[model samples]
Target: MKTLQIVFIALMTIFTLNAEATEYHVSVNGNDNNKGTAAEPFKTISAAAKIARAGDIITVHDGIYRERVNPIYGGANHLNRIVYQAAPGEKVTIKGSEIITNWKKEKGSVWKVVIPNSFFKAYNPYSDVLMGDWFNKKGMDHHTGEVFINGKSLYEKSNLNDVIESKPYEEALDQEASTHTWYSEVDANNTTIYANFQKFNPNKELVEINARESCFYPDQPGINYITVRGFTMNQAATQWSAPTAEQVGLIGTHWSKGWIIENNIVSNSKSVGITLGKDRSTGHNVWMYNPKKGGATHYNEVVFKALQIGWSKEIIGSHIVRNNVIFDCEQAGIVGSLGGIFSEISNNHIYDIWTKRIFRGAEIAGLKFHAPIDMLIKNNQIHNTGRGIWLDWMTQGTRVTGNLIYDNTTDDIHVEVNHGPYLVDNNIFLSELAIRDWSQGGAYAHNLIAGKIEVRHSTGRNTAYFLPHSTKVAGVSEIYCGDNRFFNNIFIKDENGEESEQEKENQSYGLHGYKIAKYANISSGNSYLNGAKPQEGETNFVEKTNLKPTIKITKKDHHVFLEMDLDPSIFNVSTSIITTELLGATFISEAVFENPDGTPYVLDTDFLGNERDKNKPSPGPFENLKKGLTLYNVGK
Candidate 1:
């Protein structure tokens, strides 16, 4: 009788899967009236999305699609996913801009174009300045709208003089088209844009305006179990997505679960690129969370609302964002709020993330995530960015490992107010200010960190850790910025290293006030090379040094490079690698990453996806990552 029941369940599963599986096709030259078949493809992706069900597949052909795709439904699970793919080996470009060709010449290298108010019927990004909760405008108003000429995003100029005087080449960041500036004026009936093309003929080149709010975003929530693959989504006039607001991006998985966004080139946004964040909600009580009459309340209200709106393990985020080339944004390449729980972000190459130095905000980085409960960031190469990874509040059971990060304007990893049991390991951090810690209860091991290290504790600011496999918030108290461990790592300060960059400004590197918090942070068995100095007057660090380690160092293309060639038999870390005495918190030992519930989440994997020796793992990301391993260059 039990065997019969088992057979009945298997049959039911097969029947349900087969009932849901279907295929759809989309093309630029097709018609919306046609059925979404290979020979009779739909014209718009939105049309196919309206009819697609769970376990369906939508294959888009090679062409430029000039519309936004708002998917309403995600499939049930991984096996029953709603897959959206570019036709195999075909190029797909989805743009949020419309081609505007009716430009009349006004002055030298300046052109004027008038678009009717009715043209932007529902939305006009030009009228929307970058304003939101917790946003620092820097006393100037930057708009969400943008103008692009010949596939490059032009700068937004206030006046014709600002356009003529704009020197993009002299800009500090390596920008593609910053020299081309534009200005917009909106009246009751029409909107006008004055642009500087800088001697380029506007009649010959392709010019476009911000016609859509987002490139490939769903306006509604709970779009889950969707896989978007092999496309180039760009040129959106997206607004700022603070946690308090509805976090939208060029392509966002807003408040979704089990989504896989892979193998796409997502670029050219006024704000964020890809966002895995919460829906509109009242965020925690922090810097700007409250205003006199109209501001938000405290952290307990935020947590209570999360509970009210289903903050369980099944409802919140568990998305997979991997292998995508995301770049060229004023804000972040990727960002997430409470919706980044139980997620894996790996193998994505992110670069050139910040160009707006005139505006200052706490929400800009290559990747910025708030409340990353058990989130995994691995094997991703992030460079030429403003800051690499900013893991803010509620960062318990998080692991940042097996990744390559460098060429950032600020620190590679910056952890703010939290009582963490987080781990940082096996990373190549070649930045000027790597590992800027403001929180504590972290264990650092087997990393190659290069920069000034600093930590700060606060009495007013605080964060929370959680109970495992759940959102039952625990360890909720004032900020504890201590109980950290540093072991078996490499710190380099060659003349060819970070000191060269600091000396370019005649500035000094390394910790300036590190000895004050010596008891809070601990260290051991670390190697220092080329005058790389640790915090002076700190006697708590076990086996610390400042001289060159017994290793080879070389330079190629203005970057300092080094590797360990010692015998494997001689490579062993002490059993006192980590303990309750080292980290001022309780921990369970696992050969791999375990969740708060003692369930195995990840185990013994290197940056190259190679297995680490469970018994005696080597120091650093590569067990044997040699040959064509380019660390750095003049241009990345």
Candidate 2:
């Protein structure tokens, strides 16, 4: 009986080993030749990625990995996703920068570094200037390469003389800093970078250069079902990514599907931080303007072939970029074109985008996306940026809710050239210009708009929309900024629970269109108080009432936005304008509009993830401005 029991136990142990998933470990002290175990781990993540299969977990210890990690394969299914995670509570840094210890002092506080051409090997970003489809060269040379000192990126000077002759870096307002300026000159066999680092010893501090093009990206296409989490990824020599060009980001999901990149710190990217975009081919007719290099057919032939090959769900992208802290990018924190279909980007803190004018382009924002069909962007705090969010082109069936946006230099949210059925709800817009509507058919409800609003009639602008949930071209449609609605909102300029002096002086009448034409728009059930005046002549706003609900915002946290407490019962007064009416474009019904995946969605929860009473919900992103109702609030 004992022998029989031992045999059965051995058989059960073998079966359990077969069913269990593998865990691979990586540490700095390990070697690639060693077995990927906890004691004998691999040296690099690239080595682990080469052998990692479905249901494998790569556990990297606390250290800085200088090399880029290119995932060759994703999992066969979501359940078998390959996860790459930093050890719990460990600081794992995956950087695209290489420390240069070969610097020779040129003069007082000026240094020069000569890198052999073999150092870069296949690709040299210093020689590669920024000029591509939809990219304006502006008759000047611009490289994707960057130089960093101690962590912050230094300015790239046009010439060596500019850095050498310049005085102490000027703290000019709204201008790019010239401190620690650098210039690069590339020859056939070497690339030399000269920098002026006044008062700082280059030999003592960590001076790094943007050596790699991307920090974490797969080379080949269709690498899906992967998760990159809990690491600090930074300092890539990423170039300007236009929809027409081969779009590359610091960490981009390139024309793939089902990727989740969460809980990582992405920063100091040269152009863009994260890209869930198409893999460069001829997109729409956006290349016609830059005809000197190539015509429209020449630039877009690859896209035409791609379309013929079928731009469907199996080929396009649907990625989840959530719970990330992405900042310090020149162009955009997150930018996507056409590849953001059926994706969810939630609980990400994206800020400090496009604050530096060192790189100039029309494409600059905190979060800019093109053709985000049925994508959800929620519970994000975007502040201190140029443009908060720019949803351009075919933005059908998309929902932007539970987001707190404020202090943007330009318009907080710009919805351009989209047709209809998109929903924008429960957002806090506090800035100079809130919503810039070039094309309409969006439903705006339960929002707190504390800024100016503008509308542009773009009936002649021809755009495209995709089939719901797929990238197949639905049809070509012109921009018709009509049949829009705004309801159950709170527009105010109260400083301290009452009208500010600016509101009393009629400075709050900051809503207007170009006034060339008016469309069928509805604006009602909105409480505009604290001396804020209703927009005139165009919108069908309900009669304005002067009632100020108490707004409580405390600066408890230092980095991101503060928490607010505004009890919903405070607005439950006798003169309240609350109702159960459907907000926004009423014509956007089942017959005309459905979700991209043909599924239906209801905004049943507030920004704090609390259930909302659909019959009479309060205004703004909170169901109740109770304390502790933050993005991380778990309905306590």
Candidate 3:
């Protein structure tokens, strides 16, 4: 009975170990011959990722790993989703080595310059003393200003004196060194000093950087959905070659999708930190052509309407991008212009964007929607950029609401050739200026615009343009400039305090309109309050004299009618009168007349002529009339 109980316990222990998920441990000091368990671990992350399967987690132990590890090739298998995570209370740092090389010493130079390794411990005051102590205990001199590693220099020649002065080598050997801690000056020089180190965790600071060519993958489509989390990648500035047709940080392909990059710090790269390819057709015609149509002669000119749904048919909708922090890149951060739809970009802080010499402009918006449909850009803070939000041609049904934009060098929100009904509401634009050309159909309501809103015509100058002539028709028009109810909007000119009475009087005489009508809503608070009063004009009437008959009416039963055509050009005409009269006579039937060309005209009686004599008749029996006229003439 005792032996059976012991056997049951042994079986239970083995089953518990087998049921647990696989955990591959990685450490800088581990040996290659050891297993990837915690007790026996591998040294490099590249090796650990090679043997990991899907749903497997790679636990990285604390230490600075001074080599680059490519995780893309091993991460290509769909069943092998690799996760590189750090252990609790342990910081796994992947950075450059901190040794000096290429020493050139000359007389009267005041100091010798040497290039340091990418990740040197001398940048931090606390870590510098430890590094100095390690060198001093090895019988090396403490007066040396710098150290070289792998034939590369770390500190500049001008910074050698500051580096020597800031060293705590002598104080580190004293008995009172434990009570005092050193702090460096915070300035641009300090930023440059920190830039030399590949990674620096200044007690409470989070360090993130990326090395060039550290991640590699083949150009294929089956390798989708790669995720990277909780890492600081320090990329060398001059090491990264220009991006070819087949290269990227997370995944390398001309066309690839379903990548998840989050919770990582990346900096200092040539092309981009995270890039998704938009241009295909480099190496093979297979990926270039549409595969679902069974090789039906793919033409590059044919563009697909929806890319995200066509690329990954398993997902019922488009993908989601959220919760990422990207900073200090060579190009626009998070550029996904590869024909995607229904994507959400929220809660991301993208700033400090720099451009190359070839490209002219820079962009640092929290979210940029470039020709995307059914997109939502909300609840983001974008500031100190070139342009806050930019929309190019054919952007439809996009809702830009609840965003706070300020302090940008250019416009806050810019849109062009957009046919969709944009709902721009509740957006607070504080100290922002926008110069937009045209808007066909949209609603700009409930927005708190503190600055000037300038809408100009695209084809002409900055003067106010009129609405088109065809807007008064009965069909549905594209522009709905109604219900936009502006209330409590204040406009302060430059001469608000110093406004003269003469300038006020000149402004009171408003603009004249001949072919177009104008609507002026001047408030009581304006300076032109008592300039012009509204007046009603007098209506003139006319009596017609000579009328023309349409046909010769000789029979007694035939009805005789007089048709008189009055001229409206003789009246005092104005735009307000014309607009009111045209609107009032839209439904009257008998007063309407049509010209020979079938165009409608109005019969106003202001210009008809009167007859000279009313007693004259045509071909009357004139014997009694002539005798009366003769007697009257003789008596007179």
How large is the C-alpha RMSD of every model relative to the true structure? 4.9, 6.5, 28.6
Q: Model 1 clash tally? A: 0
Global CA lDDT of candidate 3, please?
Answer: 0.35
Q: Candidate 1 residues 542-625, lDDT tens each?
A: 233344333333556654455433333333344233333444452321122355455543336655567766654555554543
Error of 3 at 76 (Å): 11
Candidates sorted on lDDT, descending: 1, 2, 3
Per-model TM-score on C-alpha atoms: 0.86, 0.85, 0.45
| Root-mean-square deviation of candidate 2 | 6.5
Candidate 2 structure quality by residue, lDDT tens digits, 181-207: 889999988999998877777888889
lDDT of each: 0.73, 0.73, 0.35
Q: Which whole-number lDDT from 0 to 100 does residue 482 have in model 3?
A: 19
Those runs of model 2 whose alpha carbons end farther than 4 Å from true positions after fitting are: 1-20, 136-139, 167-177, 281-306, 493-518, 535-554, 557-601, 625-636
Worst 10 residues of 2 by lDDT: 572-581
Give the distance in Å from residue 97's predicted Cα in candidate 1 to where it truly belongs: 0.9
